[model samples]
Target: MLFSLLQPALIMKISNIEDIPGHNIVEFYGIVQGSTIRAKHFGKDMLAGFKNIVGGELKGYTELLHESREEASKRMIQQATDLGANAVVNVRFSTSSVAQGAAEILAYGTAVKVVPHD
Candidate 1:
């Protein structure tokens, strides 16, 4: 109820193309990007360290990264929509360690308006 009300109704479409397939780019609004950094809690960090030694996927770290990426992507789309873009093209993602126990995620793309090719 409250969660649904707070959620965005529209999520701008994104693609790894200069223009959407089968569509024409009618406008270009330059580049847009969103980034965030996250770190695991001390307990999760210790658990992850043990998992690393055991050579298994660190579930906590994986979920942290996944959530970070989703947040970044949502922010990027919001920025593009604020620029009056209906879509974001040539989307790209990047990740890097911002600190010993923290990682940064970035989502970037060119904001554009597109319509189906006639």
Candidate 2:
């Protein structure tokens, strides 16, 4: 009874579908999370009168933001998995300002486990 053992691990109850593992999901329910990210500005302040018609890439800032969002999403997923959830659905993403100089990204969805019929 692998599924029985993973009962508590399930987070979502799919009240819609009754089959799972092949795109047809069972009636289970869970929560899924997602995040979005944006680049950051560095110590080098933007000059008041300087404007580039084409936006030059900011490597460090871009990397920092992309990595941060990825880490955050992974953490959320891991949290769900640790709880014994096997699948996540209806995931959505969002972003917001965490501070004056930093932003936060979030990913959310339904976490659940599929139970097969006899």
In lDDT terms, which candidate is top?
A: 1
Please name the candidate that would achieve the greatest TM-score relative to the true structure: 1
TM-score of 2: 0.55
TM-scores across all candidates? Answer: 0.89, 0.55
lDDT of 2 by residue, 12-105 (tens): 3322233344554544445655465554655422521133344676555567667876666665566566666666666656678877656778
Report lDDT (CA) for all predictions.
Answer: 0.86, 0.57
In model 2, state the lDDT of residue 105.
81
Instruction: After superposing candidate 1 on the true structure, give the runs of residues whose Cα lies further than 4 Å from its correct spot.
Output: 1-11
RMSD per candidate (Å) reads: 2.2, 7.9
16 Cα displacement, candidate 1 (Å): 1.3
What is the lDDT for 53 in model 2?
Answer: 40
Candidate 2 regions exceeding 4 Å error are 1-21, 27-29, 32-54, 115-118
- Residue 116 deviation, candidate 2, in Å? 8.7
